[model samples]
Each structure stands twice: as structure tokens, then as C-alpha cells.
Target: MKKIAIFAKVHDPRCLGVAEELVTWLEARGLEPVVEAHLARHLKFEPGTEPERIPDSADLVVVLGGDGTLISVARLIGERQVPILGVNLGSLGFLTEITLDEMYPALERCIAGNFQVSERMMLKTEVTREGEVISSHQVLNDVVINKGALARIIDLETSVDDYHLTTFKADGLIISSPTGSTGYSLAAAGPIVHPALDCLVITPICPHTLTNRPVVVDAGARISIILRSMNEDVFLTLDGQVGMELKAGDRIMIRRAEHRTRLVISQSKDYFEVLRTKLKWGER
Candidate 1:
């Protein structure tokens, strides 16, 4: 890749040093490295680009931090389909599967054109209020509809492909992609789906009716939810990052976006190994 973009969680102390070293390494190889304006200042680099503009010209993007940071960059990527190398700076991450020690090796493989990528599905979410589209977002993880701490249990009238599904009476609801099954959905007792699968999971958070369980649907299905509760402190969150308060009668539409996130697979480990390490699977 000629122009490689670097996105990082600048707040993490470890990221600064890693980024500095990475930049130096890229320059030594006669490759161009781009950093965010804010982070470039910390690294003493001249004339850095903005985050939103990084994907416009970057041939590949490298993300440094946890899964949250990777998710943010995924959103920024939108429909670019650029390959991303995610290096975890902290604990084990689902998306940031490559650890700090593996970063250089992964980069070497990438430079040698010997890397593989996993195409992860993304969700397109649209908020419609009073017959007007207010906002739209693309998320790599789950779209959460939740009530405030003091708010009462909200009612979400859900449907699939225009077919009416059950009305979920719960603290919240999570609609996640196969890649997001291990996120909020998992914490809400939803099933863990393999990322290679093309499906969506609908999970309820503390449903009043215990029978309300998580449901998996086809990726082509058009899922929609309408807020049936009034005067409730409810909100819709995208990837746990962007959010907006929901009003009564608002319609939230979700579908598999045409855009997909391309993540560079780590050569050191497989998916099951990652699950075993992250989940502590089989540990007594």
C-alpha cells in the first residue's frame, strides 16, 4: 500500500510510542504514512490529515487500540472497502485480534501482499421521525435501543421483512450483525454467531416476558422497530458511539448495508483460538 492511514486511541499512553515507531518504520521503507491531525501533533509530524479524509486516499488503514477504536474507524470507512489491520493495545478484542507483538509481522505480510482479509457485514440504520429521515449511520457492531437508567421498560414493536414480529417489553433491544454477536448482544444473553455467517441477531435486554428470546434472521431481511412508548427516556445507539434520543412514534429501520468492512486476518491465530482466549473457554 502506498498511502497507509493510521487511526488510534490517542488517550492510550502506549499508542503514542507505538505510532511513533510505526511511522518511522514506514518512512524507512519509502512508504507514506498518514496520521490524524490531533495524533500527528503528539508525534511531532507535520501537516496531518483529518480522520474523515484518511480513508479517501489511503490504500490501507491500520487501527491501534481496542475494538471500540476499530469500530469508529469502520464507521469512518463507510463503503470504502479498504483493508484494515487492527492491533490491540489493551485486552483481547474481537475485531482487534492482532496483539502489539504481532503488529510488525502482520505489517510485513501486508507489505508482501501475503495477507488475507475477512469481510465483515455492516448494518445501515436510519431514524425516521414525522415522515422525515433525520439521521443515518453505518455500524460494524450492534444497533441498540435502550431506556435511560431511571426510565421504565419501553415497548419496541419489531418486524422483519414487513411481517409483524412480537412487541418486546424490555429495558432495551439489540440488533446486531454476526460480527457483533459477542458484543452487547452476548451480554444480554444472546447467542454467539460465527462472523463468517451472514445473519442478524435480535436480542432483548431484560424482557418482562422471559419467553422473549434472541432471534436470528437472514441478512437480506429488512428489520424495523417503532417506538410505542410515550414520554420515556429512550434512545437509539449506533456501535455504542453515536446516539440520538428517540421520540414517540419514531420509526427505526435497519438492514444489511451494501458496504462491508474488510479486516486483515491475523496469521498467528484462528477464530476459535481468539474465542478461547477472549472468553476463557473451557476454563474451570
Candidate 2:
């Protein structure tokens, strides 16, 4: 039997019902469903091991929730190269594009090893203080650095590949992967890039100068930013999930990670269909 891992947002009341149905379906088909440990209590069935252990044991992963749940689990499955099928239980989602009615068919395809995988690029961000690396995170979305609500405009000395790019005087800056172009980058008026493209975009939030605009750089280039202002409330955030407070003289470097998130796509679906449904493109 192929070991299939399942994860979900346990807080969502809707997941409990669907999870029970899915577990029974998997069992009847001679498939072993390994559910995340923490969600066992919420789900109406006997589950498998811890969520982190899923990456080690399972051949495939199924995520049942919104984009945030998938991202949180994706962090745990880093570098594993396991194909993930994200089912949308929340509102319209870009990552979790598959719907409830289409779940079983997608799983059947995955089990038969006939699904298409999208190798989406990920970002690696490092925080250095006084030449010492303090923290690092691998994220699927953008790395954002911004000031607190009450703080004044800050200065970030930006560079690409050991060369000085510019010193940005703005509320903040965003370093986004192509997969994240539709996220916070889009909100900052940055361009929407296809996930299949191997590149990154840097956008300035409320930049001091009208000419300082969003810039897209090659994926191989290393983008660095040094906090030039002192005694201010600044932060470095990843995937809009976790974040850390920033200090003056802090240096942040962002680049493409060695591994990418392998997303399982239905054979009947295409990227443009998802974009059109989510964005309501060309509709009157």
C-alpha cells in the first residue's frame, strides 16, 4: 500500500467531516492514510504519526485547508521533493486551487503516478547582525522588511551580487519570488510574474522618490539589504507567517533556495483557468 500523508487546519469545523470521508475512501482502496498527529483529535479517525514525520515516511501529501495551512506544512517538508495536492477548504486560493469535488480524482491520478508536478521556486533569507548570521528561513513567498506604524521612513541600503543597487528611502521593501508575485508584491504595485519563470522582484513600499520603482532581477543574483536607520521598529517577515524584530545595522540577504516546492496539478486544469477564476480576469 502506498503511504499517503494528510494535513489540515484542525480549527476549521468543515475539515473534520471531509477528513473522515477521505480516510475511509483511502482505506477501501488499500491506501494507508497518514494524518498529521496534532489533527488526530479534531479528525474523526485513527491517524498516523507527527506532521514532520510525514515527509520521511509518506510517498505523497494531501493538504486540506487554505494557503496558510499548506505553507506551514510546506516548511516542514523542506527539500523532501514529495508532490503535494492542496485542496481548497477556505475561500478561493491560488496555491490550494483544487476544490472539494475534484479531490478524489486528483488523488487517484497521484496514486497512479500520472499527475503533473509544478516545481515552484522558493526563497532563502538570512539575517545577519555585526557579521554574524542570527537567523534564516526558507520561504515560498516574499521576504518583507518594513517599519512599525508609528515609526518614520527608514533607510535600506540595497544591493545585488556585491554591487550597490540603491539606498531605498521608503516604508519598506519586498523581495518576492515568482510564486509570490501575486501576493504582497502585487499589493505593493509590483508586476505579476508566472511561477514557472526563474526570477525575483524587489518592490519599494511608498518609496520616497517617484522614480524608485519595482525591479525584477535574475534568480541567480543575491539581493542584500542593510538597515541604515537606528533606534526604530523594523521587522523581517517570511511568507507573512513568522517574523523577527530588526535592529540597526542588520543585514538581510535573499536568494533562490536549492529546493523547490513540488506542487501536484490536475491534468484537466491549467494555470490560466486558475488565474481567471481567482482574479475574474476579462469579466464584465
Q: What TM-score does each of the candidates earn?
A: 0.99, 0.97
For residues 75-150, write the lDDT of model 2, one tens digit per residue.
Answer: 7889997888999998868898888999999898888877888889999999999999999999998899999999
Per-residue C-alpha lDDT of model 1 across residues 25-129, encoded as one tens digit per residue: 999999999888888988889879988888788988999999999999999998988899999996769999998889998998898889999999999999999
Poorest stretch of ten by lDDT in candidate 2: 39-48
Model 1: colliding residue pairs: none
Best by TM-score: 1
Q: Pairing residues by index, what is the TM-score of model 1?
A: 0.99
lDDT of 1 at 30: 93
Q: Among these predicted structures, which one has the highest lDDT?
A: 1
Q: Name model 2 segments beyond 4 Å from true.
A: none
